[model samples]
Target: MNKIERIGVYTSGGDAPGMNAAIRAVVRTALYNGIKVTGIYRGYEGMIEGDFKEMVSRSVSSILQKGGTILKSARCAEFRTPEGRQKAYDQVKAAGIDALVAIGGDGTFTGAELFSKEFDIPVMCIPGTIDNDLYGSDYTLGFDTANNTVIDAIDKIKDTAASHNRLFFVEVMGRDSGCIALNAGVAGGAEALMLPEKDTAIEELIDSLEEARERNKTSMIVIVAEGDKNGGAYNVAKRVKEKFDFYDTKVSILGHLQRGGSPSSFDRVLATRMGYFAVNELIRGNRSATVGIRGSQIVSTSLEEALRGKELKLDEELLKIAQVMNI
Candidate 1:
């Protein structure tokens, strides 16, 4: 049980909405507990470069509603090497940073787990990805906000598709998980969904479209996860057009738009809770764990346990509901 004094926090990997909110919560919570906080910019890159700023309660003011992270995020290929990690540790020791709080997805947790073990530093993680792919947490920090963004775009596309009598293929993020696609599909009433978790063939998609056509669906939208086997929205739309093109076909790649926006009521509150929980965990001598929400309760899991085999979050019941709703 290391007596953690000064703790450093950073956001890593891809940027997501509600990240700023998490940052705010972390900074304020640490300050409230009479702990010193340092903001690590650009993730591991910043740690290695010694790019740090002392953070206080006012440092995070008016940032709760902002999109993206104030600390920012970036991939650090250098951090993958022993030499780079050694340099980061040197910086941490020099700066008097005794512990760490990382906010990101799987890659972020993997790095934290390794760093904590090697340096024997107390660390905690906040699941701050829009993908919601992590297992321990019921919902990641930015997932709800990203879902809202996707449904907003889908609703607008639905209006245009209805007016033009078109079949729209909308692609959402999630290269490894389908949490965004599945939730957004059910919410948007998509005609079909192609997820990375499930192999959805073009022929099967055509058949589903054919059924929709028979049911006289004037305007149809199909949600495709970015990692779908048949490429992305454009390639899927092309394949579907070659086989069955009942209505004019179009493709819309939502791209990073789903990664931005003011987080919803759910995400802001969730981020705040997770951030506060993470700081407390570190102060209690807990190390190398991630803060997660089970049902209504906030919980902590060792990073080693949290980073176990990839979590398949696609809900079977949700898929059935999506199918029934489409019909």
Candidate 2:
């Protein structure tokens, strides 16, 4: 492989907490290795439009605690086309970027994988989604911070639920994964959880609520993932109300609030590690991969494997624990 002279870094897809930390690591690590870094604004759209900026160590300074990304992010329909990709390649060559470090989730990786194969430019990915649904990484960036945000809301909501003896169906931002809902639900001591991985029936949910009432529980909470088959928290709460009116029902959709917050220590460290490794891996000539952590160790998986491999499943043990503890 030719010697890498310049690397381009960008964040794409939905914004996640700790992305700036990852960007900081990528810029500083590349500079430390004597390679120039270009910040690609607005992801693929910027790549095609030549919205590039020279990145220095000072450019990323003091952004570690920041939420969202310094590079910004966007979904580019234009990037999915051959013509658009060709334009992006021209811009990348014009900017003299020899390699790339992409930050985001599956859509980001898919684009990176295609862009690398088409243009033969080395690319590495960092898992920066809060969903934690990506296959390669055990934990994605912002997952911890999102969970913390949800738990904080749950704690505060619980206060009102207790005061009114209400049943709160709190929805979190896991559209396809239950990592956020399950983890936060358990941590917040919710009475039940409706996850995407599990097709929880309305009858079963009512049973849980009825059981809670029988146990003389003053207030109950049912955490729901956004992708729950029963529709969102509002729909589930509506169905539950039709049958069981034991307590006043309410719905709290966390919405985009989960996507914004100063990253937790774990996420900051994880993003930094992933970002540092992504640059080093590209320098080492191991291209087209995603950086991830498995049990405290940072590892790289090929893009093909990371994108095509079986998705990480919800832990059955954790599911059982959530159920047992809810009692």
Write candidate 1's Cα lDDT for 83-174 as tens digits.
Answer: 99999999999999999999998899999999999999989999989999897889998899999999999999999999999999999998
Regions of model 2 farther than 4 Å from truth:
none
* Best model number under lDDT: 2
TM-scores for every predicted model: 0.98, 0.99
RMSD (Å) per prediction: 1.0, 0.7
Tell me the RMSD of model 1 versus the true structure: 1.0
Question: By summed lDDT, which 10 consecutive residues of candidate 2 come out lowest?
Answer: 310-319
Please give the distance, in angstroms, between residue 290's alpha carbon in candidate 2 and its true position after superposition: 0.4
**Candidate 2 lDDT, tens digit per residue, 122-170?**
9999999999988877899999999999999999999999999999999
